[model samples]
Target: MDFDYDLFVIGGGSGGVRAARIAAAEGKAKVALAEESRMGGTCVIRGCVPKKLMVFASEYPGLVDEAAAYGWEASAGAFDWPRFRGHLATELDRLEQVYRRNLERAGVTIFDQRATLADPHTVRLADGTARTAKHILIAAGGRPVRPSMPNAHLGMVSDDIFAMPSLPKSILIVGGGYIACEFACILNGLGVEVTQYYRGAQILRGFDDEARGLIAEMMRAQGIDLHLGTNLVEMAPAEGHPERQPTEFDAAMGMPASDSDAAGHAAPAAPRGAPSGPIWVKATNGSERVFDAVLFATGRAPNTPGLGLEDLGVRLGRNGQVVVDAYSQSSVPSIFAVGDVTDRINLTPVAIREGHAFADTIFGGRKTAVDHDLVPSAVFTQPELGTIGLTEEQAREAHRIEVYCTSFRPMRTAFIDRPERVLFKLIVEADTRRVLGCHIVAPGAGELIQMIGVAVKMGATKEDLDRTVAVHPTISEELVTMRTPVRTA
Candidate 1:
């Protein structure tokens, strides 16, 4: 509600918006923020929010099956693509309005324009309008990346899947990252034939090996095809018949165009809540399968391209993320950075923490720094994986940590007729007895890991956990009751 702002945020993402408002409220600095797209950054607008929606959408199919097991007759469900997509859009529209209202209520000027850093002190808007501020913040976030290929233009990335031109009946997904796995889980659970290709020996390369193996096993049982240590060689349409040939990585899967040979094969139908067209996929493995659609969950990169940071001499990481100091300060002291742009700890809550910490240290006169260690997070894949502090391997090397690992079927599986089991592992330092690592694979892993994360953060010992009164008949109770070490230091 004023003239030139004291702080002009270049991107109105989670970090930027929070920073601007906090700085103004307490810094007494008039603040204004600009957003090129919908606010809430990646997590709210494109990344986590929409991805979780797809997860819930996918889970309904499993729920239907379970309902029948509970003596309720349930048939194969039907999916109305446009209706589901429309509902998601409607909710997001409401969310966007809420974000705008929150910013306005906080007394921060919200500008709907793309922003570019003119210098450390000045920013230029998309429409050539200019704003000056004593302090400038860059939190532009990231963009989805694609590999160079013949049919990349026709394929989809994580950001594109939510608003697909059509749902894929069968999909060949490339890459082994969480993005790829999450999408595969969503599509496969929704009844789409899914084939995942990873260049590495295992998917979720950074997670515990057992969890990865079990996930692969479970997905295979559920009918999701897995191809590890693979890459795409070529992509070409099937000639006169559909079988297997060479084609783009995105289009691999299905009966190739000519494999079906001028006949459309009645267009393979998908189960309920699934897309219709078979996704074509080409993997690095020199195998080609034709599908009606292709999705590449390659990964994400900082969305700093349009916002000119290089010209300002603001140092960037090898991945193009803005490099910041311990205090989240960029090369320019008056200008700071936070969130995904920093690329240190790319999580929603981490961004919020960094934003608040920066405001506290700078305006409130308190010292703060983000600790990359002890940053607990979860990946919401099928049989979710959650971890905090060091992994077993990391702890073993860092502190001579002895890993105490266990695998067992859950009580629910014993009674509910589900075959999936749970795995829990703990890493405790031999010298200090302090628990350093935790890995879990099962329902509520995300929720359960948070408590262990607090324990590790507070320097809890193995004995402390063992002595704590554990609630009985719970999977987490197992975490506190392991007697023998799976491996010693």
Candidate 2:
């Protein structure tokens, strides 16, 4: 039986939605999308959106403390976890409705049930309803990977933690990635005791060494129990892993990477600038701690399970991410995979671009592939870290890189009486003079790094950076005015 539509999309997340909407609006194709959960997908429902809101809620905790240091004497502050949770609920509700309206407007028939490929072109719903299309796409995205501590099932991943019924008094995060650092800052800032446990030398392993150092110093000062060079041996009903229960509990993860190869296979290398280990971690240091709650910011795995990729012989990387060519297609031509599922560039915007490129190739007759280089990333930790292009470590390995690094207190911090300083670094190629990377750890590095990203992406050179007029009275001006290189090989 031939399918009804010209295009069918699975996993209605950022990538899925864009592909569906674009294919429908511009092409002569009918489209339908299937997702078990709400249409908003991971970024909107659990990943970015909710995580950021929680971050926003947590930021206030520092302000409350800063008030006192600035000579404003105020009463003790209290955190209303319930109130904060309520605000998140309201916002989630609004976003869900918006997603449905957008889909309806785009003429996408959304199936609110689990979808799997019964065959190459046929997708089956939970109710046994079947739909076939000329082309099929998988955009199921990824999920958090829990740590391998004994009885670690009790801990929460980035996804499940948001749905936690009650906020724990203290959180012990096990990992040294972006999520690990972000949560440490968030929980600590919100007045919840946070102890970060990482089994590596530094918290952010692959990030610029200086940025990682600055973050470590600030987090320790902010009261986060920074544990480096240790890991959890086990987890029990109690904080100390005592009070053994006779009843059986499912372990979230099977074993340590060294013990069981992380669930029957070696784990993939974490993100670039990531410490030498997995992601969900923002950095590294081999260590351990105990707390009221243990959360895994270890990393995420691609969502390729039950999507029928195995049955169809779709190629996969060692980490189980679907293997695709530069054009984002599976081994089977009519079947396409994108986003975290492909693990090419697992970012919301990156996924969106893949979707557009896929749709363009299929519908608009445009031949294009998403580029991984010159990609920019930001970690939402306090004094957030943002960077684009090469890190000094990566540049040193890839090219004869030159580095220009600086550290200065932010203007606001200068008067605020805190000793923390904003740190920045620039990496450039020694030969071509092209700017290879830019990094900043500061108040609004997320915003400031964008312009530098534009500069580095366009093959900006040392001379280009030197000749550009500095915008006075701004932190960003430091990029253009940086006259000397700190290190060169």
Candidate 3:
């Protein structure tokens, strides 16, 4: 059947853009991509790029102090949010332009508007234009969701961080995930009094317990008011409000509070003259505090709402993510989905890989499927966390594993008199000696893990790691030099 284009891709995120560009350029298929927002999607525009830059900016204060200990007179001044934000804005603008230009150069038409499925093979744009295609791909990605609590409207999400008018004098961050911990460190480094409330006993859930625990310790040492086993009771505008009200539970909910319940609380009516001001929050720990801003990194939901996917009989999971097969093909023969919208390995690199594999399979006739295992990921906190392969918990449940772990102050921190310690851990199969996991907690952990990831992905055994000569005096040398298993089971 004749169609407006060979392929119509909805949502110009990393996955959608890659699919559209590849289908058009390589497959010589007619492609049109409709994006409601900017071209680069979450990772490029808001998530990874900007967040990493903020991570870099946040580290300067500590570096200045360390320089002083190294006999260099150095001190950090107040961070200029206006100036740094302006440069960040320019960098984002430049990146968006690059995304648009690349799509255009690849002979793909770009629609700078939201597009949703009208049918298995039809997409309707926001401007009342319906376009038909032989095939459609969904890559709408995800968005940060605000907690549905009383006066939660006063709180901000990850997206709101870049657009903040100014860095708050103090911030109350809610959540135990990477986003919460990352911004807590970032804001604290930027000289804000940052308080973090994670109902979970520890942050960075699903990671190495030892690594995350060390990170929690480091964060506390760095002056983050981290409250474990704590949840919010109620909140209101700090200014022009009544005196503090006692919370119902002196010791509120336990650790790992149900986020859905907390996020769904409706805000009470605000008093008159309650213009924008600080927020007052009562916690599960029976404490009340006023914070200049409340940032909720509680969670992110798939951007599948109102996209017309469900209406067209596209299968959706409980979380509203599109359900797809190994090849990213939807239940509908003519439709497919990838990236965060599919809820399969929601990292940006994974999305790109899925998108590329989908295009190659469908258009290029390569019939490729993305390898979902052992994808490297990092949390860009003050001292970053990088990991690949299985966690020790997963390894132990599945195999007879030997664990090698070490923690010590590095040479750089040695001179600074900082108590900060670095963690290097490995989980290997006891039988085959295959390295099952690699996790690190230190500066540059992210960069270090990328190389380690290659080894782990290659099915490198512990012997292979042992045979490689250690790079002397480097933190990563421990990966090769550690000869004895600390624990085996």
Taken over the whole model, the C-alpha lDDT of each candidate is 0.75, 0.77, 0.87
| C-alpha TM-scores of all predictions | 0.89, 0.88, 0.93
Report lDDT (Cα) of residue 84, candidate 2: 77
Q: Pick the candidate with the highest TM-score.
A: 3
What would the per-residue lDDT of candidate 3 be over residues 1-489, giving only the tens digit for each residue? Answer: 899999999888899999998999999999999988898999988789999899889999999999898999888888888799899999999999999999999999989898888888888889998999999999999988877665666677888788765677777999999999999999999988899998988899999999999999999999999999998878766654465332211112111112234566554422211212366889999999876667889999999999988888889999999999999998898999999999989899999999899899989999999999899999888789999999998899999999999999999988678899999999999999899999999999999999999999999999999999999889999999999999998
lDDT of 1 by residue, 141-209 (tens): 877776765535444567767675346566778888878888888888877778888888988887777
Candidate scoring better on lDDT of 1 and 3: 3
Q: What is the Cα root-mean-square deviation between model 2 and the actual structure? A: 6.6
Model 1 CA deviation exceeding 4 Å by range: 1-3, 236-281
Ranking by lDDT: 3, 2, 1
* The 10-residue segment with the lowest total lDDT in model 2: 272-281
Alpha-carbon error at 219 in model 3, in Å? 0.2
Error at 132, model 3, angstroms:
0.3
